[model samples]
Target: MNKRILTALLLAAALVVSLVGCSSQTGGSKPVEDAKTQFKSEMKFYGSTTLAPVISQLSTSFNEHYVTWDKVDSKFDKKDIAIYVSGAGSSAGVKSIIDGVSDFGMVSRKVTDEEKAKIEGYQEFKLGMDALTISVNPKNQLTKLKDSLTTEEIKKIFAGEFKTWNDVDPSLPKTEIVVVTRDIGGGAHEVFQKAIMGDTKVRADVIQAPSMGALVTKIIENENAIGYASYGMVNQNKGKLVPFKVDGIESTSENILNGTYKVSRPLIVLRKGDMLPQEKAFMDYVVSDEGMDVIEKLGFVPNK
Candidate 1:
């Protein structure tokens, strides 16, 4: 072979090796870049009024921090990723997911067998715990009622057997007691019924509110009215509502954590079948240490 021709061939071979090396390095990183950019366009969460505020705050934090692909990039569009949180009731939340109306359903209680039957292979994620607090209007004259009522006495009062305040405690006034309760299908109502009423039905004469906020409003407006709500709701309305001790145990986070609060229930999110990557990511953030911190701040006992 000619010397010049051999040298040219060697140089071409060298250039081909360098090009292959460069391609291998860059091509290997393409998948990593794609993983970083992958995200859901939107996610919809509906259910449990009790879990709404906490999830809503989480949605905000997730959108602000986790949803971003590049935090330092000035052109990164945070609005492209969206999370919608709303609550009708736990039952509604579950139904919404079954009906294909939402990406997730939040419930403040364990999934009922009936609810489980609605969707094949549905899964529940326990995010936190919440104690149901009995509340009355702050102006009610039965001031000692909070400290004195036993579980049996509470059952009697809600059962309509004790029609007047004096019927439960002779020391109290004879004013007709106004019973308030959550409407059927609320997870809070389900938990309250199991924990407080047992086999006894809540009286048909009682006033039923559609949501925790509405129930709180009803209790606050009527001095003679009594109702139950999540501890978080009562805590936020402390001045307007008086939280009662259940079986002499105060509905505190510590009591819930220590297992002394009898009225407590699990807060959960439900999904049917396999979770999408975005849904799994959101759930991951919810159970993370940072997410548990958010749950604790909302007055619920963190699962972690």
Candidate 2:
């Protein structure tokens, strides 16, 4: 064996080793680049404390079941979908969408024409129907005196015209009636205003609760309290409170679904401008049969 031939063979082996290393590096980098091309980014849905519980749970289930937002766009990335939900009230949710701060907005009432005009290409989705129930503590004297309230009487009670139980009815006690309400920013407040108050105003001294849950708790805590809440929340508290029939119509599922519950409002979601692939994907899921099932389970009348 010649020394030169042995050295040449060693050099050839070294060249092969270098080429193999380069191939391995290129192969390793390809998958990472491919992964980057297929990612779906996070989205934020803000608004409607009433709708928050439903949407939050739906988002959780969506993230769990759909690894990617492929239901709407097959070309979308294969990353897990993330929709962060928070409740700051319905008006706040609408403002967030208008300000480009949120991908979607949830509202428990219909969007007034004025609100829709502010956003370009504004779109809304109806999730369900929720009734606004006139609730009082089960122990309230009114429960013993009356099974129902006329719309006109409700208007007077909230207008501060009727200050005491005796004012509402002659036979009841004279204890001062406690008027409770959601803040003006809440969709529930607006619904109550339109449906029952008409041009009348809520009493200046009304107790304003921050959310439906808070309003229910306030009614439960105060025997003299009278206020409005979503029928769903009222049903959740069941025996703890009494929901008065409005104009002889109860807020039953049949009444709400049949449009006989005059105080009910639609649960809605809004998005402005062109729909993002992820946004459309989510919105579609929220109205699907499965999504409607979630609404029904949460005690609202599903739109379907």
Using lDDT, give the best candidate's number. Answer: 2
> Across residues 33-135, which tens digit of lDDT does each residue of candidate 2 receive?
5754545478888999899999998888787887666644678766667788898899999999889899889888888899999988998888888998999
Error of 1 at 166 (Å): 2.0
| C-alpha positional error of residue 54 in candidate 1 after TM-score superposition, expressed in Å | 1.2
lDDT tens per residue, model 1, 1-304: 9999999999999999998788778783343446546555678889988898889999899878755623413344444557899988888888997898898898888787887988866888898888878778878877654564688888988889999988977888899999988886577888888888889988879888877888889888899999886788877776888888888898888898787888888889988888866567678888999999998887778898
Best by TM-score: 2
Tell me the lDDT of model 2 at 277.
64
Question: Candidate 1 has what TM-score?
Answer: 0.79
Where is model 2 more than 4 Å wrong at Cα? 1-38, 67-75
Checking candidate 1 for backbone clashes, the offending pairs are: none
The CA lDDT of each predicted structure is: 0.82, 0.87
Off by over 4 Å in 1: 1-39, 66-79
lDDT of 2: 0.87
